[model samples]
Target: MEFSAADPGTVRPGGRTARVRAAVLRAAGDTLAERGFAHLDLADIARRAEVGRTTVYRRWGTVTGLVADLLADMAEQSLPRTETGSLLGDLKANARLVQRTLADPRQGALFKAVIAAATCESKTAAALHRFYDTRVKEWAPCVQQAVDRGEVPAGTDVHEVIRAVSAPLYYRLLTCGDGLDEAAADRAAEAAATAARAGVYVLG
Candidate 1:
């Protein structure tokens, strides 16, 4: 099922509609973090949010649609990328941000649940892709600035460089189960920076 950002629950409105959305989304996130996606039900979420069942059903439609909007809201509410002068500094900052999010108990569990859902659900997968796309675009400019400053090759793949900084951190989060700390974040940033300097991310 194709999902559009322009869908009912995806758009951010104000007043009562916004409050209802916020409460429902908070409830949805809590459900995902605590019980995983399989247990997510619109009626249950409505009860949790103290909103009307008809309201939740009318606004979000299906669980997939609700999840899609939840992902969208997360992308919208995520903190903006930081600019730290140099590529290493900026990459380190980005890495640390990712590390902190994955280290948080609730956020980590929510991500794990969403990722598990994405594996089997095409709409969830699409929403997850969109979430990453938004984040990558937010951080990609730092790599471009590095290129302008001659810190990396002129044709370095900016998005890939950004992705590189977070890939290892995520690997540890999902599989290694090691300490996903700031030191690990620094190492990931350093590795990506070294690769970018060596033109590993340069477009052919």
Candidate 2:
């Protein structure tokens, strides 16, 4: 997944401001990955970024705001969905992308910290929801293509099918503590494809 600026209108591209934002965000990600959310301090983040404390405070306002912006950046930077001309292929690509991200030490730790924080923070929850929504929407077209090609029922809930492909991978990440291997990703894609073909995701 890739990461973007907080507010488009307020953001100017290709300047010292952009550099500062990038530095601060990188520092924030490092802090979260290394120490988790409970220890994320804006002042320390500013120090790590070599930015002024007042700049961090005036720009982000609070830890929650900083995190929310960070999530927005992540959503914006997410890779575009792959087009494989087949639902299973596209879904496997998506699953592998998710698996690779979850298997990386730094990225996995960063996501864990953010997810843990979202459990009790409304803003964080909303940001997390938006991030997933962006990803799902990016890949949902593959299921729709399958429907158009008569591979699945016309009434299939495309978004749900896309969601299903990554659900198990995330479950394993959060619960089973198993390695997110290519086999797991392929299994997730195959299961979701099978379910879609079987009309399991069809809407009444």
lDDT of each: 0.86, 0.83
Q: By TM-score, how accurate is candidate 2?
A: 0.92
Cα displacement (angstroms), candidate 1, residue 183, comes to 0.5
TM-score of each: 0.93, 0.92
lDDT of 2 by residue, 5-109 (tens): 232213436788888887888888889889999999999999999999999999999888888888777777766788899888988888888888887777777
Q: After superposition, how far is residue 81 of candidate 1 from its true place, in Å?
A: 1.0
lDDT of 2 at 124: 86
Residue pairs in candidate 1 whose N, alpha carbon or C atoms collide under 3 angstroms: none
Model 2 root mean square deviation, Cα atoms: 3.5
Top candidate (TM-score): 1
| lDDT per residue (tens digit) for residues 1-204 in model 1 | 011122223346678989899889989988998999999999999999999999999999999999999988888877778898999999998998888888777877888899999999999999999989998999999999999999999999999998999888878878975789999999999999999999999998
Query: In model 1, which runs have C-alpha deviations exceeding 4 angstroms?
Result: 1-14
